[model samples]
Target: MSGLGDLVARLLGRSRAPVVVEDPPPTAEQIADAVRDVEARIEGRVPAAVTARVHRITGTVEDMVPRLDRFGVGDRQAYTVVATATSYLPEAVEGYLRLPRDFADRRVVSRGKTSLMLLCDQLDLLAVTLEKISDAVYRADAQALVAHGQFLADTFGQSSLDHPGPGAP
Candidate 1:
């Protein structure tokens, strides 16, 4: 017998046909349901303490970053951090926020808005979820934002770090 036949015979202990099974492709509703499940899991995981920490971190950012008027950010545009948060969250958040509808084709730019929002949203979600899971809360301080910014600058560069001021590259 050929090697292939011999191997098959040995494995099967006789000549048995292999069974095949096919799974149906997921539908759009199924996909949406899965996404909703994931969102619910995330929401359930986040705790009150984590929410507070995230709130504090956001407050810190608000305090450190100049107001849009002070920085001359356009009224037509959303704040960088808010944009970033929206972008960073699942695309669902952006869709929910109706950003495309609101902003139209104005080109908000990733660095200008999406990235910052995403970072803040992700950090806040993680902190909240983890604290909820563990039943423990940890408060973050303004120093944490400074440290995070410094770390980003060190890792990337001053040019890459998102600073809310004119001439910030």
Candidate 2:
């Protein structure tokens, strides 16, 4: 039995399996673009109401800065409200929320250790939002959208990872 186990282990270890460090799943921009493409392909198949709601929600967020900034809270807190409110919107709204900003080219990519830290910060914000939101369905959707946005922002470009910093990809 020991010999057999050893043989199996050796075989497994020796197998030159392509060491695939799956480059962290396609960034959110990638996913959002795919979703939009599918929506476009389907054309009128997706409900008009859903599309309308998504547009409306995005419009609301686009104009939210004044109200959010007026409260004297930090960007993270303001983002929290944005994330939560987005959850209540329709799925289409949630889908569109994943779209990357037009200015992704401006972000600076941190290599190695710095990249790791920024990645950790992104994950922490995601976890925190999940824990804070009460509604399960909404929570899940919001987290997904938030994660997508973070990825898109990162892919596009981010100036800062800390408080009062520019938004994440």
Best by lDDT: 2
Candidate 2, poorest ten consecutive residues by summed lDDT: 97-106
Q: After superposition, how far is residue 80 of candidate 2 from its true place, in Å?
A: 15
Off by over 4 Å in 2: 7-12, 15-24, 54-169
User: lDDT of candidate 1?
Assistant: 0.43
TM-score for all models, in order of appearance: 0.22, 0.25
Total clashing residue pairs per candidate?
12, 10
- In model 1, which range of ten residues has the least summed lDDT? 130-139
lDDT of each: 0.43, 0.44
For candidate 2, lDDT tens digit of each residue in 1-169?
Answer: 9777767866888633455664543333443344444345435533454444334334434444334534344446554545434332223233333433232222345553332234334434443453443244345668989999999888977655544745635
Error of 2 at 125 (Å): 21
Candidate 1 wrong stretches, greater than 4 Å: 1-45, 61-66, 73-79, 89-169
